[model samples]
Target: MIAANNLSVNRGGRLILDQVSFQAKKGRMLGILGANGSGKTTLLKTVTGFYPYQAGSIEIDGKPLATLKPKERAQRMAVLSQDEHVSFDVPVYEAVALGRYAHQQGLFAVKGKTDDDIIRKAMEETGISDMAERSLLSLSGGEKQRVWLARALAQQPDSLLLDEPTNHLDLARQVALMEHLTKLLASRQLTVVCILHDINLASLYCDDVLLLKNGKVICQGETQSILTRGVLENIYGTAFHEWKEPVKGRKQFSVVTRV
Candidate 1:
């Protein structure tokens, strides 16, 4: 299980995250929903040890996250940030192969058949096999995003942490990416923790939702329970409408007013 016990983070004398606690188990997908500046990114970074916390603890599979070596931690978890900047002019295939660095015996070790298989499979899963030879600087935003996701998948992580993984993608691509990721999570029993801006998408994809307001989790439960019109209206300060879908017979919620 991945867990945070009283996790807190302060930046430049300002408290960004405070006493936040949550848990995600294998086969579970946790969606974190919040408005801008609510510390969603900060939480993800802190959990992955990218940012230092002021207090509390983070653990993965009963081990302290801080105590784990860099390679040891990368073996268990992979993180996808909202924005990825690649300064190098590396080819896409070589970039994805970087994920195998942790599994390698040394810095200059050659990759074996297993590594090749993983890289190929990950590229295929993310639908980026054709772009494998393209340079990272030559691709569009969505394509670059998928390439990064493929790299993370190539790591063969037990858990994933994503910050708006589908941002800037078209509707079809967004749906396809989420479907692929959800399938991987279910089949591999991977724990997924993600920060999503679209509540509707989160409702459709995630098993559990954690609603945050001003850096604190206001409520958390099953997606269908916490994604009601009333809760969203209060949290986002907007008028909302909720109704059942005509075809699927599932609850459909939408924002109706700016205020």
Candidate 2:
């Protein structure tokens, strides 16, 4: 499990996060929801040790996140960021194989059968096996997102962090990615913490939700409890309507806008 207690961060003499606290349990999907500049991305980066906290602590599976070595941390957790860029024209397969770097023995370590199998399966799972030979620069935005996801999956970590993964995806692809994540959560017992702008998607896929406003946590709990119309409206500064899906009986909602 990933847990943060009284976490705080500052940048440019300005507070970006303030005494934030939450736990992402094993075998559950935790959705971080907020409007832009609410510190959603900052929190995720702090958890991954990319940013230093001014106060409090972050722990993964009872171990202090800061104490872990870089390779050890990579082995335990994988991150897929919002903007993934490939500087040079590299084959899709090669880019995906980069996830295995933590597991490699040395700079010149030979790829083994286990590594090859994992890479292959990751590509196949992301529906990019056929594009293995294609250049990363040649793929569309959505395809690149999938490839990045596949790379993270190849890490085979106990926990995964995603930052606005559905940003460039079309409607169908967005749903498909969420469905795939749901399956992976159940089958692999993966602990996931994702920054998502789509409240409806979070409602459908998240086991827990954390709502943030101005770098502070406004609410955090089960999806059904924390994603109510009032809470969403307060955080997003917009109106919302909540209802259950007739067939699935899942709670779903939409923003009400004035035209």
Candidate 3:
């Protein structure tokens, strides 16, 4: 499990996050939601140790996140950021294999058959096996995103952090990725904390939801409880309409706007 207690962060003398507290348990996906500049990205970065916090603590599986060595941390957690860029042209296979570095004995360690198998499995799972030999630069935006996800999967971390993972994908691909994550959560028991702008997608896939407004957590709880039209309207300052799916009985919502 990953937990943040009274976490706070400041940048350029301005507070970005304030005393935010939440926990993502094993085998569950936690969706972080907010409007622009609500510190959604900042919270993810702080929990992953990319940004130093001014107060509070982050723990992973009962161990202080700060105390863990770099390799140790990488072995337990993996991050998939919004940007997917490669300075030089890199083969898809090579890019995904980078995740295994934490498990390597040394910088020059030779990759054995086990490493190859894991890479192959990751690529296959993400539906990029056929593109293994292609240059990452040649792939489309959605394809590149899938490759990045495959790389993170190859890491085989206990917890995965994703920032706007569905940004470049179409509706179909977006749903497919969420379904894949659901399988990963149930089969591998992977804990996921994802930053999402689409409230409907969060409602469909998230087991828990954390709503933030102006760097403060407005509410956090089961997805159904926290994502009511009132709470969403208060946080986004917009009107919303909600309805239930006739087949699944799941609640679906849409923003209401007048021309």
Which residue segments of model 3 deviate by more than 4 Å? none
State the lDDT at 178 in candidate 1. Answer: 81
In model 1, the worst 10-residue window by lDDT is 244-253
TM-score of model 1 (CA atoms): 0.96
Error of 2 at 232 (Å): 0.6
Over 47-91, each residue of candidate 2 has an lDDT whose tens digit, in order, gives 999998899999999999988999999999999998678889999
Residue-pair clash count for candidate 1: 0
Using all chains and alpha carbons, the TM-scores for the candidates as numbered come to 0.96, 0.98, 0.98
Residue-level lDDT tens digits of model 3 in 1-259? 9999999999889999999999999999999999999999999999999999999999999999989999999999999998668888989999999988877897798888998999999999989999999999999999999999999999999999999999899999999999999999999999999999999889889999999999999999999878899999999999999987676666788889878
| Deviation (Å) of 202 in candidate 3 | 0.7
**Which residue pairs collide, candidate 2?**
none
| Candidate 1 vs 3: which has more lDDT | 3
Model 3 TM-score, 2 decimals: 0.98
